[model samples]
Target: MGAAWEPGGAGVLALPSGRLVRGRSLRALPPGPPPQFALYLAARPVAPAQWESRWLRWLDFRLPADPGAVADALREAWQRAATERVEIACAGGLGRTGTALACLAVLDGVPPGEAVAFVRERYARRAVETAGQRRFVRRFGGLATNDPSVAE
Candidate 1:
């Protein structure tokens, strides 16, 4: 499977495994066809039915997503990114979206401590807002599998 839309520039990061995914705001979806897989993080249930979607019940502009669920979702997203157009989105597309992208970076063999910076450098300068969100990315490697490259 190929991506429905190829990411031209920022908002997309390439993993060490050669998988690519995009991070964006739910309110600022890139112009083109909808992604093959859309992972949404929000306080309330606002996930659209227009595409294959997974909603993590995360509080808007807050830290701490259900760690277990997030790990699972990130793993799934990582695996699917190999063959599908995967997107991670949140309200502002900076906080939660950035955190998730950082986690995915870890899964791609980026050190946990550097994952946030990696995403911010490639995705957005403001990616991964808040100290708690940064901490989450730092500890994400331990919460998930031992091998960051392999998704369970």
Candidate 2:
């Protein structure tokens, strides 16, 4: 919670609240100042990098293995984005990273129904690849809030 990303810079996504988070592929990680915190969604254990990071057990082109943990991590990322260089990433970046970014978008006040489209337009054109991933984004607001009324 010590820095902020330049809005519209490189891979950064500017949230509605003016916070920013970068979304990228670990495979082709861009050159830049390292993030203070990152949320990594991957099936295998991710070795820690110099900067802080949290890895969620998630598969490519699919939903997270633990939705609760993902919601928690996304919330952390969203909060950290207020003053830190926050990032969300996965192997391909389009599927898992995009899905996570969509979830974060929802956390930032984007409607769940439009989060996927919002992320695609702002983050990547092909964000949230699979139908299942799309469904996860749609239901993410409920998952984040633990809102039983919102349905799974």
lDDT (CA) per prediction: 0.82, 0.87
lDDT of 2 by residue, 1-152 (tens): 34788777778888888888999988876877889999888899788888989989998877788888888899998988898999998997799988988888899899999999998999999989999889988998888988765434
**Model 1 stretches astray by more than 4 angstroms:** 4-10, 146-152
What TM-score number comes out for model 1?
0.88
In TM-score terms, which candidate is top?
A: 2
> 149 in model 1: Cα distance from truth in Å?
21
- What candidate 2 gets wrong by more than 4 Å, as runs, is 148-152
Clashes of 1: 0
**Tens digit of per-residue lDDT, candidate 1, span 1-73:** 4663364644778776778898888887677666788888998877466878899988866764577788889
lDDT of 1 at 87: 90
List of clashing residue pairs for candidate 1: none
Clashes of each: 0, 0
What TM-score do all the candidates reach, one by one? 0.88, 0.93
